[model samples]
Target chain A: MKGKLNLNFLFALALLATAAVLPLFLQRTSGGKYNMIVLTYAMIWAVAASSLNLVLGYTGQACLAHGAFVGIGAYSIAIMVERVGINYWLALPLTCLLTAFVGFLIGLPSFRTRGPYFAIVTLCFNVIVYATFENWTWLSGGYAGQPITLPAALSGRLARYYFVLAFLVITLLVVRQIVKSIVGASFLSILSNEGLSEAVGISAFRYKLLSFTVSCFFAGLAGALFATASGRVDSSITSYLHSFYVLIYVLIGGVATLAGPVLGAVGLYFLLDRIKGLGEFRYVGFGVLLILIIVFFPRGLVGGLNQLRDWARERRSARSPGEEVAG
Target chain B: MSFFVNQVIIGIQLGSQYMMMALGLTLIFGILDISHFAHGHIYMVGAYLLYIFSVLLGINYWLALPLCMAALALAGVLVERLVYRPLRGTPSINTFIAAIGLLLAIETLVRGIKKDAVRVPVPVDRSVSVLGMSLEVQRIIVILGALVILLLLQWFIQRTRLGIAIEAMAQDREGASLVGINVNRISALTFAIASALAGVAAVLMAPLGSITPEMGNLLILKAFVIVVIGGLGSIKGAIAGGYILGIIEALGVAYISSTYKDVFAFALLIIILAVKPTGLFGERTAS
Candidate 1:
């Protein structure tokens, strides 16, 4: 089983590497600016959604304040680079640290509350962040938000895309590592049985906080990247609505697996872009999609695929002896 | 002295509205163990229903108010039947997402119809002086309306058979069911009452301020805070939480910055969650 898992990991890594390079090669031939931009945004969302999956998907803790943490990261980087004249590269780590600290603070209180209560607390946190961002004009530039200037090395859309892609890859790898680690096992255990996990000497409180803080750190990192990518940081990006959007991405993609959020973010971004003309009706579509997906495909798109594969294996195993198997 | 008195009255008025909105949310949370995110949007819809009756149909605002409530009650039953009933034994998150989806769907539908520019008309006759301080007549009406509705709701919950069943179910769903209570019926009734209360609030609120498609977003957040701080399943907690939040908000806006007015309640929620997760009146239980 361990060897098979390692082989699967290697296969996934190769597939990702090939896909990453294929995009660059396609960019050269197709010259699809719009496509590239869409792809870039999708990748950014993928990072954010996956980070959320660390908490919501793996830990079974539903958070509605994710966009606020993203805002914190975005605003922090923008403020540092724009006003304090700090280098963007240097500011990224600082932003992540600060966001992680804030996440720890938020998580502490949320630990006591379960399910809906926890979600409401996170919702309140998001509102507070938004209110502060809009009111603390001196710090966040109020509703207008602060304009961001990209570093000299990363000026063009193509370059920015690659930069974002690189960040997404790194964040994915980090998440993958965490999920494969003992801490990840603990996280899964907590999600499965919080009481049993506690009884089994795994401190659910400590691990829950750890998962939350780590998730927030990456979410903040994505936010910082997003701020630079968009060239502006606004409270609108941190709105409760945006948080819901991210949640939608996580839910629709498949929360249990690592690649679920990636598929969801990329899929939903393009889906929305395609139906942009629907205007407000777009949300109606999105909402309906969420309900249908939850009611019927709770395992999500990726999880459903995994189930199919498992079912195929079972069928093959149950086949009569000496039956020829065709691949 | 008049200034202080005026602020107190305004605070109470705001508190009353908060209580009216929070009461339904509290009851739903207590009974269903689910957070109804669409409740605010329903309130928004109710206000728009009033807008249609009074503005378009040319009905009297007083008559339109009850009409709006009746419509919302119908909508509530539909939502409960279609949405809540399907996910009875599902995880709470499933219900939460469904509620969010419903909120998005409703808000989007309203926005599509109104082009997202619809605002509730402000009632005529802005300022009326009581003693030395002047206040908005609409504001006073809103306060009175909220208080009357809350009193009626409280009476219904305490005195009525359906209300008693709801209370019992809220206390212990399995136990209530074992005692011949129709859990599904009570759940539907709870949704109906909550939606109707929200409708009444919308009507009262419409005259006081302009209604926008997204207006309910902030109101919902504030209501959640009130419900949480009041102690999840406790009606008295909801009332106390609402008044406390309203007073704090008014005072915070007066002394601090108006832009940060919403932050006070949220900050309070976080503090309460951290220090005492069960809220002021909620009992702590291990799940």
Candidate 2:
């Protein structure tokens, strides 16, 4: 019972699997297909948000330039595949490499600042990357937006959905592994006390740079998937606002939990989208919710639920005489 | 020479505006250690409140300025007590995320109220020729108003007992608290002063251009750039950085491409931060 995460972990896994094949269950109506496509977008965002969680939640470093990295990935794919006529398959790996390299350059200097200083510096970087994307028409296709699509074999709607879902699975699994690994422990140690970690020879700088590059690699992957899945990459994708939304997902879903970003990305995405009359209230609501969540439950939805479960168990054990003590 | 002088006037005007924005950010960061990312949006809200009081309620523009400032002071205190106070002792990133959340909420709320941009009627609707360049009365007012407020702020921070306590708080929160300086009062006061300064900037600049909810977005980033360039919490640094940024932007636009007008400050930020992480005027502090 103490290792009770298994049940919820499996539950989150079920929900994600449902997102992948839900179209197969639903009639092949346009509405069904539309929902599937939205989920596909959410899946990509889940990957992006999870990447952020790897750095922000686990490592306790908030790299706010996440949206810029996503933009880099999107543009990498679009520029290579759309303009240079490179194969999509080839551009996929190239996009990841390019984004990781960029992340390394950024993280080297960025890790120099810590905590909120780091957050603001990264945010400034986001502003610069976005400005470049908006102003560099020759490369970014300008604000009019550049078109991109998957290979013909993967161009089918269901194929694109499955492709994004597959990547989300891969990101979550790898992130889980990293979180449970010795390197993951180092990230947490730094998060708790950087000076202490450094004093103990954990090399806080190297670990942070590693987490940042890894997260950025996934951000790029997600961006490339978004470009192909949505069939376009625009300055809109590069907007600093996108950074806030990605952070929002991780915060609301559950920071530090592997299932948190996935739950957050998919749950909040659908809730905001399905509620048609929400209009501007959606952002206002998300903002207020984000604040309230941080104030009340810094651990997020998953963390909140885990606390509730613990409380409920304690109450049950107190009330029942026949039950052995629950952990 | 005329072009250069005209550009200098524009730079001074812009420099004052940047000072208004950056000072608040620096003040908050110094005293409270939160970046207050929503400041640009708060400035936008202050503009909207000014619009509501002056245009919507038919109040005089000058009268509405103080009214807006007072209201935002109340708002700043409330936000401090509510949004930020609860998350104290948590990680700095928590507060930063909260700031982003608050920023989004405020921007969208204002957008919901009014999506289209509207011009605030210029209280001083005239121009003057200076150094062979036509300077509008409104532009001069913006510069003078900002400079006056900044000077007053400088005096208050340096001279007053409360201001000295505020400075002490900025320098050392724990030390200030231990010495019987009410950390809560100073924190709330710092936020109030910061928020009101932003309001003052917004009110002054509202007449110079059309106002929109999105106006604060770019301004906030530039303000952060200024704050970063000046050293995060240095008042003098913020002031210097503000003017330097404004002049660079004005001249860069005059001589270089306007398309990259926004990029100049950002480039300056990266370069300055790379060279001197302590900022040009920031003292060395532990990470």
Candidate 3:
């Protein structure tokens, strides 16, 4: 068993190492620069989606304000660097802390309701955030979009790629640690049976609040990285449609699994990018695909693959009587 | 004071449209227990269909209106049969996600067909002075037209057998089924009625301004706010909530700021959800 665990760990490490070095490899190939940019975007979105997973997947809460948190992070960096004269690096940590605090406050009222009601409140929060970004001309620069000035040292695409990659690693590690810890078990318990968990003396509100705050902190980090790489922030990032896009990533990739969000973000980003020429009809296919996925593969791609493997193994065992009895 | 009255009048006009949309939403929520996220897209379809029938096909507006409603009713039934009915026994969230997918699909279809805004020309472009305030004749027609439809809808619900059956199903699905209500048929009927209501809203609002694919997002959000305020699944609540939201929005835009008009509904929703999850007219246990 220990050997098997070691093998799994080794494989995961190998995958991570490949992912870490992928952008450098891409830069050498034809049209690699654009691919690198898209890859960086995927990684950044992966971080956000994973943070969203903390609420939607683990806690079984439908938090539609995730993009708003991302927006908050991006706008903070934009305002601080461009208007407040704070150093980009110095402003990031403060911005994340502020976002987490705001998330905690928002979660207080947002999580008070249950199910669809909660979904709407969070969605409303998303709208409010976007409205603030759009209407507050003095603060967010309104519809013109605010630009972030990355320091000369990290302005290069490759450098920014590595920069975002570092943050992605930290986010994934933190998420993995949380999911593997006692809090994660509580989260799953809450998700599996909320009323029973409460009966068993689990303070549902506290754990959920903790999850929301932590999720927002990381999402804010991802937002800062987004601003650093893109060098601009706009109200569109905070729009509820963006929130829906992030939710779709988590849903399509697989919910409740750590790798699902990453797979979904990267997969869908590239898929959409590849079909840019389709323009208006592009999302129509995705919409149908989303409905099909929800209906047939509620567990998402990873879950579907796991099921296929199990089916294959079962079939093999059935084909051999001796193996079947042993199994 | 006259400005306030004007805002109130404008609010009533906007509220009438909102009421139409929310009526369908509340009815769906009452019976199916699903929010039908794609309902807004159905409204968008109604607008586009109006544009096609009245503008492209050169059909009369009076003729186009009924045809649009009937088409939307058929579309609603198809959506219920094809998309929603299969996932009926699953978790409600699955249906919600499916609805979102449907919204995306329909919105993309419309956007792909016409990226630019499509305007529906009203027969009456003239304005009339009422109590020293100028109001568009088309606006008054839309308001009176929506009100008449709403009253007819109320009468139908109160006086007609099919409407009573729908209300019975909404109140208790299993019990109504035990009484031989034909649950499947009623489900389709409820969806049809709701979609037709949304169609009415779309047609009325289409002539008021430029119609765009993206309008569904704002319209749906407002309808949601109204549904929440009036209490989910309560027709009366939806109507009251619609007027409240419309007036507040009109006043907010007129007095406070036009740019932040959308913020009022969402902010109110948050407040309502936090303070009273059941809404003013909602039952404690239903949602």
Clashing pairs in 2: none
Please give, for residues B152-187, the per-residue lDDT of candidate 2 as tens digits.
Answer: 998998999999999898778899999999999998
Better of 1 and 3 by lDDT: 3
The iRMS of the candidates, in order, is 1.8, 1.6, 1.7
Put down candidate 3 lDDT per residue, A97-198, tens digits, no spaces. 989999999998777776666777788889888888877878787777899888998978989888888888788889989989999999889888888999
DockQ of each: 0.66, 0.65, 0.67
DockQ of 2: 0.65
- Provide the lDDT at B218 for model 3: 76
Per-residue lDDT tens digits for candidate 3, residues B1-287, read 88889899899899988989999998898888987888989999999999999999999988988999999999999999989998898877788888989999999888898999989898788988878989888778878988898899899888999989988888899999999999899989989998998988888889989989988887887898788778878888998988888899999999999988999999888787778767889874223
lDDT-best of 1 and 2: 2
Q: Put the candidates in DockQ order, highest first.
A: 3, 1, 2
Candidates in order, TM-scores: namely 0.94, 0.95, 0.95
Models sorted by lDDT, best on top = 2, 3, 1
Given candidate 2, what's the lDDT at residue A33? 77
lDDT per residue for candidate 1 within A87-162, as digits (tens), equals 8889989999999999998899877777766787798889888877776788888768899888888788788888
Q: In terms of TM-score, how similar is model 2 to the real structure?
A: 0.95
Model 1: lDDT of residue B34: 70
| Error of model 2, residue A48, in angstroms | 0.7
**What C-alpha RMSD separates each model from the true structure?**
2.6, 2.4, 2.2
Please, what are the lDDT tens digits per residue for candidate 2 over residues A207-262?
99999999999999999998988888888898788888999999999989888898
The candidate 3 chain A region of ten consecutive residues with least summed lDDT is: A1-10
